[model samples]
Target: MSRTQSIQPLIASRSAAHRAARSRIVSLVLAIACLAALVFSISGGEYSITPAKVVQILFGGGEGLENTIIWQWRMPRAAAALIFGAGLAVSGAVFQSLTRNPLGSPDIIGFSTGAYTGALLALTVAGGGFALTSFGALLGGLLTALLVYLLAWRNGTAGFRLILVGIGVSAALASFNHYLVLRAELDVAMAAAVWGAGSLNGVTWAGVIPVSIVVILALLGVLIGSKSLQMLQMGDDLASALGMRVERAKLVLVVLAVLLIAAVTALAGPIAFVALVSPQLARRLVGSGSLNLIPTALTGAFLLAFGDLLAQRLFAPIQLPVGVVTVCIGGAYLVYLLNRGTQKIRS
Candidate 1:
């Protein structure tokens, strides 16, 4: 009825269009960056295949040695890094949105530690085949999530309470994991130690294929529930008033997020900080408050690919685990976040 009211709708529509366009643009840039990182990872190892040869190999045109290096070796590792990174980033976005907390990531909480504990158990008790270890890790992560959820639930789960409970549980799990490793035989301990470090060193197609499938499927589930996830951000009461089954929605989203991160941890041994940092970084980059899953996933893929490259190339003869690089980066990022928070409180 009013002219101002008529103009308000047009303004809001334009703002939405602007944000949508920006998100698309940011996603495209991040995707290109991820692709570039993948290419570099495939091409620039110690063996040093050229980018052109990398492309040829990817498309089925390279010679024997080149094909072996690309297909059998580098491609799997590179693919794992990219795929796992994307999954971790999406999982981070889900938890952060769920908790309305920047610090709410699977790794930061206790899920990763729980997964590690499971992997350790598999190694020590079950002879530690990859599939068995992966299963153990998945089971461990899910169980840990359940425990944390139960502990954090009062009248209902609050984000801060969940995070605090997760941190405490994570510390206890880490101690138990260390004890398990210490009690294992020498060779088994060595293997568990390497796994706990979260290296991508020996990642092969056998491992990568199964993980890729699980992550892809779980990511789809997250995408389908994205609407309910955002609505839940408006608070349980509000979301329920809007006809959502709040607890059920939270359960589904939590399970999907857990599945994504657990699959990655099962394969790569809890590669840290990607899930914690990727979503926050994506939000800042996209200039939006709502979840930016696409950009976050792309950023994660790029970070891991690039970090893997650094791991391989950094020490020349000795390749560090990809986890080492991410931990360092994540540590610095954590400090920065703390400093920023402190400054805000002081102000």
Candidate 2:
């Protein structure tokens, strides 16, 4: 090649290196922020444990109410928020990459609604046990995802078609959930309503363990397939030409994303829009074209932990659901995205 061509490749390599460095720095900052949010969440709440005391209790230096509150109440809640947020963020990132559209999140594309539908049915029939509810949610989300794929698959699944079909299915499922709630017994309906609002209140270690395991497994799957996901961003034809198994990779990714959302929904009742907003926010923070999973995960954890803290203390003696807080934030962000001219839906 000519001298100019050789210089161009070297310059491009340097540019890529610089972008990678910037993405790493942003990820580190987000990780620190998430840790700080966790500490703040553990330290706040009704009794107002100091950060120092919280750390002390964490290390087995405290006794009585202090220990109980730290170990039993705060730790589980914080862990749930962190794990659930990370799972949702990674799931969102994968789908957005697959669709090549920022709007293609699990919550926006019908998975959350489908999971809610399943959970509502389980609550009505199975009397609201966690295991049964989770199983129901997983099955429902998987079926809904399959339905969307089938409906959108006229000439290989187009991103916009999938999104449009998903929205329609999600709306219908949401109406079904409402109707089911209405038909339920008064006490059962009330319980379903509360759970559906997605609060972290009363989260215990027993509930946290299973969900954490699922989230961890899903996250590992995402990490392992991250390279193929990146390849898919170049469009299916190009990916296939490069020897990637486009269809199989896409199927695995979609299934993993659905499972992650279902597991989190089962634990926290579809905490609204964390999946929708976290990847977008992380993308902005890390600059364009850099899919930094760590930053996205950390951004999610911080948002949920901080939102839960606000929910607890914002209106003293009357805590709001974490979902409510996230909905408000997500709604505002949606408006902002629309006003600023969002990325067009890819075909």
Candidate 3:
């Protein structure tokens, strides 16, 4: 073989090895971070549960107050962080692939707002609306996503047109949602607003069950579509040329993405930024050269769990919304990206 031909195999082998090593490194770092976060999360609040007590509680060894705090309060929040993080990250990954745009998320498409609107309507109009919000949110999410899909479709859909329609729908829904909240009684409005801001403080087993089931199933669906996702990112014609069912794959992804976002939003309000930044952050961390669902999910979980933990403890008496914190951070990142875009043109 010629020298260039001989060197090609060696380069491929080294590239493979490097990818494997990077994956292992990410797994190790993320594992350590997750463990530390769990311990800190358990220990962060008042009443001072030791790490040992936390572990004991986790293992079902404690009782009464400590167990109550850990088992009833912190455990659900922590588990929520895990599931929320992973679900958002996976959903973001799929949407970005489908739209071929990093900014795409359920929130951008009106699905989240629709879910929020549904939740709001239940709380304000359902006559037991408070108790029925989640179901309402689920229905709203599905309807809004379907509506966006139909509106965006004109024989075949273009990602750009769909996004524009989604944006318009989102704006309209936001107005309707605000109007409903404003019309309601102050006490009811305050309660719904707090729930809308998304905190894990009062999450019950009842709320957890449905969200967990739907998100897990949706997560599996996204994973199954990953190969199609990679192809979809290359654009419609190229994806079709590869014998992939481009339209079908897009539909499945849109559905899974909608479902994932709907489940999380219904469970925790619109926990902002995880769906926006997690995938991009994951892509950066795992390298621009590869796609990694597991690592992305793990990192997303870490960021959200840690963010929620901070939100709960940071102000103590004031108790800022977890969504508020994520949004503040996410908003700053958005500014940076915008500035970076200007810098690109200057250079």
- Higher-ranked by lDDT: 2 or 3: 2
Tens-digit lDDT track of model 1 for 1-347: 99999999999999989999999999999888887788888897668988887877788788788888888988899999889999999999989988988899999888888888888899899989888988998999899999999999997889999999999999999999989989999999998898798989988999999999999999989988989988988888899899988888898899899889889988889899999989988888888898878888988998888898899889977889889999999999999999999999999
Backbone clash numbers for all candidates listed: 0, 0, 1
RMSD of each predicted structure: 1.2, 2.2, 2.0
Against the hidden true structure, what lDDT does model 2 obtain?
Answer: 0.87
Q: Over the stretch 1-347, how does candidate 3's per-residue lDDT look in tens digits?
A: 89999999999999888887887788679867887787778776767888877876777788888878887777777788778888987887777667766667676768888888888888888743434877888788889988998998987778778878988999999999889989999988988789788777677667777788889999998888788888778789998998988788888888888888888887788777787787778777767545678788888788888888788788885667788888887788767877987898999
* Candidate 2 ranges with C-alpha deviation above 4 Å: 342-347
User: How do the residues 64-177 of candidate 2 rate in per-residue lDDT, one tens digit apiece?
Assistant: 998888888889998898888899888889888888887888888999889988988999977879899999999888999999999989867778888899989999998999
Q: Which 10-residue window of candidate 2 scores lowest in summed lDDT?
A: 338-347
In lDDT terms, which candidate is top?
1
Ranking by lDDT: 1, 2, 3
When 1 and 3 are scored with lDDT, the better candidate is: 1
Residue pairs with clashing backbones, model 2: none
Error of 1 at 74 (Å): 0.9
Candidate 1, 38: how far from true, in Å?
1.0
